[model samples]
Target: MILDIYKDAFEYSAKNLVTLFVLGIFCLFSFLLIPIFLITGYNYRVINTAVHGVINGKDPLPDFDDLISMFIDGLKVVIVQIPYLLVPFVIFVIFGIISGQLTGILSNAIMIIGCLITLAAIIAACLMSQMGICHMAYNDGSFSKAFALSEIKEVIDEIGWSQCIATYLGLIIITLVISFVVTLIIAIIFAIFGVSGAALGADAGGIFGLGLVINSLVSMFIVGPYLSIFNSRSVGLLYTMQI
Candidate 1:
């Protein structure tokens, strides 16, 4: 199943290379001309497509043709996720408010507990955000659906806790491996260039520094859409198990 998940993702990307590259470029330019909204909208579309695939028993990459709707859908998802995004900040703020009231061992204990609670809050927020977004997608972008805990629980129960956890952990490992390999390759390429540049008495520092920027952009271009699609597919597959 796991192998099939990645295989499907790779095939989808290969089939839509032009679409993927266009989306990847827009995402890379997110800081310019409000492209962030477009990027987010496309991401939301990816999730929406994933949910559709899950419900229909077939996973296919979403088309990148609906710019306006995708942007709106992405904006809706951002609205749905706002609270989850704030959880860690809220946790820390509460901790800060009470930290001054304690001292010595009590202060140390409070700090330790606060850190643990904050970490847990962050994790919970992330987990819930993913599920919440999926819920919204499944329910046609209804905001309330994202917070429907009972419905979420039913889906999770169907998927089984072990499978859910395993899928998530597997995605994490896959991401880490891809990131490490890309970074390593970029580093080696730059290292070779740096040596050649220095040997030729060119500005090796400038060449190396420029390589860093280019490498990051190249990595973003190559990895961003693929990871997004892979993650959406993984979650969608999990959601399908309930049916």
Candidate 2:
């Protein structure tokens, strides 16, 4: 299922390279991360589509169309996500308030526990939120559906907790590898150009700076979208199995 998810994502990207490229460019601009969220929401919509197709025994990679709707859906996704994301921050704030009153070992112990709790909450949020996003997509873009704890639990149960964690961890590892390779290539290209520019009496610093911008554009435009598509498909596929 994982292999198929990646294969489908690659095939979809290959077929819709121009669309992905545009989205990537928008992502590079940042626009206060609004564009990033919209693109992410669109990816969620794609995952939702893929999930339904799998449930119906016909897997399909959703088309990248309907920009307005995708943007709205992405907005809804942000709405669904903010509270969950705040969990760890809230934890830290509470601990931070109490820490000032303590001293020595007691303070250190509280800090340690606080850090652990915050980390655990973050990990939980990360895993649950992915499933929550899937739920939102699966339930016809209903934002409330994402917060439906029981439904989320059912999907996890179907997917098996251990397997779900393993799948996500594996995806993280794969993502890191891809990121490293992309960054390395970008760095190498920049170094080569910087050296050539220096030999030609051009400013090495300016050339290197330009390389950084180019690297950002390439990573954002290419790697970012591809990974998003791949991950959306993987999550959607996992959700489809239990449905």
For residues 86-161, write the lDDT of model 1, one tens digit per residue.
Answer: 9898988888778878888888788788989998777667667777788888888888988897887777777776
State the weakest 10-residue window (summed lDDT) of model 2. Answer: 54-63
Task: Give stretches of model 1 more than 4 Å off.
Answer: 1-7, 10-14, 54-58, 200-202
lDDT of 2 by residue, 13-44 (tens): 54566766877876866677767667876777
Best by lDDT: 2
TM-score to native of every candidate shown:
0.85, 0.85
Model 2 residue 132 lDDT score: 91
lDDT of 1 at 23: 72
Global lDDT scores for all candidate models: 0.74, 0.78
